[model samples]
Target chain A: MTKVVLLGPQRHVPTVRSALDDLGVDGPVAVVTAGWEEREREVGELSEHLGCETRNLKLFSRSEKALDKDPELLDALRALNDRMRTLQEHYRLRLAHTMGAVRELVARRGAQEGALLEEEIEHALGAVHVLDQHHTRRTADALGTFDERYKPTERESIGRARGKVKRDLSPCAALLVAGGHVAVLATRLRLFVIDQLIEERPVVAWSAGAMAVTDQIVLFHDSPPQGRGFAEVLTDGMGLCPHLVALPHARHRLLLDDPSRVSVMARRFQPASCLALDERSRATWDGKRWTLGAGTRWLGPDGTLHEEAVPA
Target chain B: MSLAIHEFLANGTPTPEQIDAFLADRTIPIVEGPEVTFLYRGEAAEVSLQHWIYGLESSREFTRVEGTDLWWIVAEIPPKSRVEYKLGVIHADGRRELVRDALNDQLAHDPFGSNSVAAGEGYERPDWTLPDDDARPGTLEQRRIQSEALGQRREITVYLPARYRRSRRYPLLVVHDGPDYLVFSSLKTVLDNLIHRLEIPPMIVALTASNDRLHEYADDERHGRFIAEELVPAMEQRYPLVGRPDARCLMGASFGAVASLSTAWRHPGVFGRLLLQSGSFAFTDIGSSNPRGPLFEPVVRFMNAFREAPGKPAEKLFISCGTYESLIYENRSLVPRLQEAGMTVRYVEARDGHNWENWRDRLRAGLSWLFPGPLWMVYE
Candidate 1:
């Protein structure tokens, strides 16, 4: 188990330096900014914040080189991505309809058709749950097929990159993961199995980084540009920190004031705690239980934010 | 009845001193609820408000305050409405001139010039349209391509999203009237903000301008060939695009909208999405001659023919028009026809004029629906 410190978005009010200070991590820090994609190499500010020598692992660049060197692997990755996209579209189509029905039925729950409304709501909600599970399973299957067929880690190019990453990460006091495109970040990390290499090194990650370390990656937005954004499971995370759905930029991304939506989200991802990790919020995992920072809260089942810590 | 202007004229028509005091501290176009009182002060034989609000008189004479130079007119505008207008002043010397509002500095610009903007109650510019310090900006590179179809070299402005990588392939958005969109509509800033917020995916946007905008964009055969046969191939070669019809979008406003539709119609599956804003889709369902003038002859002919057999221009379309535009009927008519032809259409109508700002406000709705970002699903 790794000791992970998850913080909110660092764009506005940066709490990374303080988080690092609290952890007493002052030596050389290795940073994985794969999420920043093209800007992965620009880590001057982050390094300065740490006030220590930084080893930029450059996982994004390394992945690019590995894929470039191996055309077969690149083609496989592309094909897999295409399949995943189709699967997601299918999931979205069904989720939209199911969520609509649920919302309608829930709104009419107090009507004269009370028992019927409740029954229909349950059925619609059940369909939603099934759809999520099916999508998750299909995603895993597709990814598994690609991994099994290609054996990416065994490939010469990828193996070389992974070896270099492990060597680069060896001497760092702690790991710092900054946020950008979460999917890209997570994919690069998984390719090199950075989670495995981290071992017992304390990891201080924020935003998408915080999401990446969790057991599951749930994409949530109440008012997206398109239809009503019903929260959906994007993919399985690295599984470093368990039983937590890290919601970075919660206030901006979610409609916390709407109790119905909040209740659905909290209940949908049951057993796991939905942490609202807005700016200045922090949650520390000491490889056992969570120690939530002041003002840090989790979305309770009754649609309220509670200050109680969640057990891992 | 106690309007701010009424208060200014409470003690009969205001004297020069009282008028000076009234104009000193008060913001022009005094908006109180739905009533907007426009005021102009000058020596003129006649002063009229020339506005483009549909269902209202295009030109309304402002009443001269008795014994004073103040010309004032109170208009009942709905809340959240933004109106662009000019003052047509007929001088004492029998000369006439159209001028922007001297008292109101807020303006909306286009290719021709600019107009004074009067924002009604509850109207505020969307914060997302402005440049944000946090939103990392995309790069725009100007490139010239020799178009064999049009037999001319064309300048194209490409917008590469911030943190763009060669490793990742992006969707392609081809915009008609590129320079105008950048200068007038703030397209670059909008794209940057939307991408930063994950409201829309980070994609490559191609801004295409024409030498003869009216002729070329009015459903010219060569223009269609240039976009479909020449431009798409060149962009795909230079950049890493998804290279599928579904991943490509063609967008434009007014005549540019006609260009987008006709091009996509001509090349059936070239572009899978079309964003048509305030489309000048003038069609003669019954008549023989073009009533909108000689400039709209080609547009009318193309639109009429297309209405007969639209034949699925794209898989999805996001069409928007201002309720205050003459083309609203045509836009509203096109939606049903598109839906009937088995296309997913999202049509939005705003209570604004047929100006760049109206188009600007609708970009978020249009772009997001066509290519939604990873906010919902990022399967990585």
Candidate 2:
């Protein structure tokens, strides 16, 4: 049973120190900032903030170098990425129509249209849910196929990197993951099997880091440059917390004020509670249950943020 | 509303001490609703307001206080309008000179000089255009490429976004008159902020300059060939750019805008997006004498030719022009023509002049619409 702590973006306010104090575990911590990409090793500020000895695993560079040395495996991964992108595009197309119908029906909820409207709304919402599941499965299958064909863990360069990561993690009592490009962070984490190494250890992550530790990654934004902000399922995460849909920068990215959008999102994900992980938000998991911080909020089916954490 | 200025005026001519008290801790160009009053406290024979707002008097004499050295001019500037102006001071020595408002610190700079900026009511300089400590700055590398079409070595600055990697292929945006835009419009900072905010994707920006822009950027075939044939291909060979036309954008303002439009027109389906600002698209309704002068003859010719056929130059175009600019008519007229040609066009008009800041202000809307980043679309 791993003691997992999920945090919001560490910009204005940071709860990592308090979270660490509550965990009762101190000393050397393994830090994975693979999402930071080129700035992966720049942890001077983070080290000072933690007030503990921090060891950077440098997973980003290791994975990049490994992929560089193994072109065949790199090509295979790129192909998988391309396939995932196409699948996501297709998912978005289907999602748009279904979501439009849901919004239309939701807007007409008070009308005298009766069960037919409610039934249509449910059908539309179900279609969206089915689309999400289909996309998730397709993404899983794509990754599964690539893994089966390439056996990335067994690859010579990847194996070497993993062996080094294990040695680096041996002296650490806890693992801290910082947010950045979530895709890069997740891929690098998977490549070196850092998830497997920190099975029972205390882990604290924030933003994209929090999203990466969840069972599924759902990308959401209310207003983007391109068009409407549709929350689309990106892919599976490390499965550290299977019941959480971590939404970092939710206040900035999401239209929480609009009940229709919020309700649609809340009801779409169903069992997995859509957590609004703002800068002050924090949630701690002790295997059996979650103890949410005061600032932690979850999207409710009524289209508002609730103080209490919805039980997984 | 600046109450001090109003109080000072209400109490008749102010003494030196009173004027100093009014000036203390006051931001210049006192904006009160639709009325903007520009103040200059100095000893001059005459002070007049020199502004570039279209449909308004080009120069208006400022009223000098009888007992004080203060000179003030009030202009009815609409809400959310950004106006740039200078003070023309006629010294007692009989020499006249145009200078920026000494009392006002807010200034907008161009190639020639800087002018004091007077933002009307409900207007604020966008925070994203300014530099942020959190936004990672991109690296700019200068590369000189020999252009066979122009027969000159051109210096093109390439901007690689922060954390740019070889594994990822980025969209390309080719800009004309790059150096001027950097110095005047703060393009680098704008790119950094937009990318950091995820409004626009991390992209490879090709900043190209020309020696003879007046001639070269005036729909010259050689310049078009240089951009489409030489510069783009050279950039593609060196950097990992998405080869598709949609991913490639051509951008410019004024004559540079003309160059961008003509280049895309010459090489249809080569570049997908066009960001044209205050384009010098002078054209004639019928066969007549060119009233815009000899320099615009070539531009008028190009515009005429383009308007005739008006084939799809790019899939989408972001056209912006200042309402105060003389080229507003031409920019506005070109939009319908571009749309008629079956191209997706986004036309934006701002109460600005034909200067770099107006172009700068429109960058976020244009670039984001053209190449939106993963901030909203992609999770990474």
Candidate 3:
């Protein structure tokens, strides 16, 4: 069984380190800090926290290497990236309009609880949901086709890096993934096929790390300086951990008090719990149900927010 | 030069018996004066002082002591203030070295630092500001409101003064970059101390957190509308705040400062006082436009508008930028414009670079001038 536990962003305090120790995940650990991009190798503090040296899987550097070595692959990836951007921009424009309409109607002066308006919003939201899923699936399919055509694993640079990483992982007890840019992290993970490579190894991920481990990756920021506060489904994750949308720093970024926003998010991403993973909060999975840790909260579809029941 | 050497050094090749005496005399003293003295003991062909508070071009050539292996310099710093400085050493063959002060143990504490610190006698961190076991701290309550102007649900953290009464009306200060000012600048602590000492009037500070600080802080009229139309009215309804525009203030640092000033300018009579620190007021001699990212285009547009229009909205405006900041010339140019508009303006430049601490240090001056406490600036 792959025992995975997601924790909060470890800034000054190592929330993950303590979780690792409790779960008995001793080193030499394989650390995937590709999320941090260029600064992936700066693991001195991480190693100190874990009480062991970590073997780094510099997936970011290796990706750059592959791109540099193959012009064809780079061109393909760039074209795909450009297409994705165009699609995202288009989606954002429509989503902003829909969300804005919904918000205004809800806050309209003396506007009674109109089921018709609610239904209309639901329909609009349904369209948004379809578009989001379609985009995510479309991205996955595009990536899948490219992966099959290129057989990126067969490439010399990728092959060598994978082999080295796999070999390094042979002695490691578990994998520790740190967070950075979610898109970059997910791309690196998909490029390396981390889910396939470390199928049985116990893993611990946090922040965007945890987000990347989920089936669907959602990007959210409520009060962004320039745009409507609408959380968009970016793409698909590695599917290692499923059935939940991981929201790190939810307290900091999200307006949890707004019932309208919370209800929309919860209902929009149906079946999957909108799990908030703030600092000191943890969610462990032993290949089954989630064992909620202290400070963890989830937004219910009923428009109510629930906090994790800490054990006595 | 007759220099009163404050730093102690063990320069000579000491014998075993004299080693203890040498170690005993190595206590460096940072003398408090109008012109502070700095000492360093390092082997280098040439040494120059590179201070953090001073501009990049402020490389002072250090002179060697008459009979000892030490590089020393004394310069007139701001009478009562603390600043960070480093030594730039050059080898005989032309290799360069820039580092912290070796003799002085006092250093500025930062995540990315090693900059040596020097404090003047009258420039000590006030005792009341630091976290005290017995001090009555103000309460910070997080609140969220729907903002149609900005098309988002924004979070606002409000600081209520101790012994706050529902019956009593308080002055309102809307601080941009609310989180940074609260966390990094220790704004609440400063407010608590200032209020407790009656240095500044007891006020309610509403920290408006920005989502895309860069984009929104520029020339976005939506943000200004959000503050004036939505936020101010909301605050009025919720808190016992003085409804008059004169009792209201808008404050921020860097782009946050730009947004605050822009908002106050955009919404006339909404805010009386503007406290801007290290504002990123970029421009060239020719026009109010220059090279920056796409987001900064709005900044230029807003600046140009401000230049063309009359600046009669804000009654009292306080503009401060660091001497070490690249925006120094722009800030300097802005002061005259505000003054020409017949607006009461105060301009200050600190020795430190563009950072939060510089803004924090100037808060006392800004707030006191804007909202003076009982008997403040008034002789009985």
Candidate 4:
């Protein structure tokens, strides 16, 4: 049986524990986050509160210095910078000579000093013009060099992080919970684990995480006076369990004011089922049917439930 | 090749034909000057030199034996075409000196304080010293054990004011993009300097690392919960945290900026001060669809919710962005929206781009404005 649980935003650890216990899934869920250490520890405690196991699986960490400072890839960047400098110097000399001749002719003819001054001025101006053009071309070449160095290093980093998660997958039922930006990465990670490791793990996500498992992502950024909320159309999703669109924080007044907008969005996107879970609510998917659990209410268009048939 | 030509021209003496051959071969025409003029493709152009000297003086005398009138040389060249040549000057001592163009912008200052025509500005390389294993606040043994609980042991560097340990209690600031703040912005060093000068109040800064920074800094519950539930408790345990709403501040840039604001907006009791730089207040598609009640609308609603419910207004809110940043327009619009909602807002527009350079430059100003120092003293 497949089970889907929608937990509320900022729900107490006891509520999360009760939901997991009722599902009969055991301890030590793999926790993937990009939060600070103290935050990660609190998450660990939450797992402890629920009598479950927890593991950290984080991908990219921020660095204050340049990306090239990482010991693993610093030398290559330094070499590239060195080469870029050499090319620029070579061009500077070429431009100086091209402008020097004009400076001389104006001086030799016993001409007016004004005419000679203008010629010297033209020579200086010409030299600067050529140098600017050459500098722009060389800078583009330098950027390309940096890109060539970064690609492989990023892949290796992702591979090592994924390897740790795969090693932690247990023999029992597997449950994955992802939230916020982890949702987008989690979907990709889930696909990688399923495709390469040949594992069957049930996964769930909240907020951005939930949006990642669906067929598409609808961004809410409004530019300008309203906060920036731009909608995105995604082609790839985890597709672990098909046909349902999971909406977390459904009860957030900002999201739940009008059911018509959701229905219109649903129709335009065309998912088989639309499940809106508010804080402290659960929408369980047991393979065949999705049961909307207690905590919050889900209202469809026309002020009624949108389900084909309400689950017990 | 061009420099080689200039050096050849600078050689003390050359026959007129040698000079002519050089000019003609390069498709450059020579015009006698005082004022030499020409038309290139029908447009007139002119060139003139203010000074010119020819012929060397006697070996014992350091003077020009043959000098032309200062206005003697001038010529015309086509607009936008480049021309290069060198000057041959006979000094009073009968020696020649060749002067290259000194107007080159690419000239870099050398270590010995001389100017050199280098490709780019020669800068001293950054001496980046990784924190010593023991230099970190806690013990290495404890860090390793804590690392196991942390799952992935990414480095987290904290910033304490110079008088932090001596201070009875300090205000706390929880910020996202920890690594970037510490290293890129030199946040700790800035704080240290500021505190030493007594320019700003001594504060305990908890720089939290955001692994999946974008997702974690979204207007979602996970990020809010992480701060309110996990981050706060952990920091409070180790540090002498004031443990009051007004003393606690939250801050971040871009998406992290909005997350900080949202966290404080949602739970003003938990976070009272906000330093939002280039905040992403726009709506995103990942969360709920509340068309009538969009995220920004709710922020207004939340403000109203706070007002109608009657509570202390936020202690301080510092919002800022660079003038040239892409988010400038959006951020400008948000200021009035926040002000109208009754937030105690101090807005600043920086002249920069949307990167750490700008953020670092403004961190000191933002901090000082939010927490001003003692009244009487001025340090030079």
Between candidates 1 and 4, name the one with more favorable DockQ: 1
- Model 3 CAPRI quality: incorrect
The predicted structure with the larger TM-score, 2 or 4, is 2
Give all TM-scores, in the order shown.
Answer: 0.84, 0.77, 0.48, 0.33
lDDT of 4 by residue, A1-312 (tens): 344554544333235566666676576565444322113223655566656566544432312122334555446555755775576456535533543443354344455577766556455545544454455456545645555656433445444545654675554354545454432353334323433432545554454445545544333311111111212232234455566555554443224454434433344234344456555566556667666665444445333445444332
lDDT of 2 by residue, B1-380 (tens): 55546667897878899888777757788888898888988889999999998788899999998888988887889998889999999999999999998989899999888999999899888888899987999999999999899988988999999989886788999999998889899999999999988888889999998878999999999999999999899999999888899999999999999999999999998999999999999999999468889888899999999999989999999999999988899999999998988999999999889999999999999999888776843232
**Positional deviation of residue A274's Cα in model 1 after best superposition, in angstroms:** 3.4
List ranges where model 1 is wrong by over 4 Å.
A11-18, A26-173, A184-198, A255-273, A293-312, B1-26, B148-151, B165-167, B377-380
lDDT of 3 by residue, B1-380 (tens): 33344323334443444434543464443454666676666567888877655454568888775554566777667655566678888877888988887777876544355577666546766454466543357899999989999888999999998767786789999999887887667788888877754457669999998768888899688999999999999999999999898999999988998898899888988899989998877654566558766677778777777877756869998888877677788788998888999999999886666776777778877887888763211100
Per-residue CA lDDT of model 4 for B1-380, tens digit only, reads 23323343366554555544554453212222221221111111211221111121211111121221111122332232122222334544556544332322222221122221211112222221223221223211111113322344444455665424532577888888866776666666666655543446667887776676655565555667667766677677777888888788888987778678767665667887889897755532344343534435533343344333424336678888866465776677766666776667888875444555457667766777777642111110
Candidate 2 deviant stretches above 4 angstroms: A9-205, A226-239, A250-282, A292-312, B1-8, B43-46, B90-95, B165-168, B377-380
Q: What is the C-alpha lDDT profile of model 3 across A40-134, one tens digit per residue?
A: 77788888888876888888887888788878878887887887777778877877777677677656525766777777777877777787777
**Candidate number with the higher TM-score (3 or 4):** 3
Query: What is candidate 2's CA lDDT for residue B261?
Result: 97
The reply for model 4, stretches above 4 Å from the true place, is A1-6, A34-38, A58-157, A182-198, A221-225, A228-236, A253-255, A259-263, A272-274, A295-312, B1-380
Which window of 10 residues has the lowest lDDT sum in candidate 1 chain B? B371-380
Candidate 2's residue-wise lDDT over A39-58, tens digit each? 78878888888898888999
lDDT of 2 at B311: 91
The Cα RMSD across the true interface for model 2 is 3.7
The Cα local distance difference test for each model comes to 0.89, 0.88, 0.77, 0.49
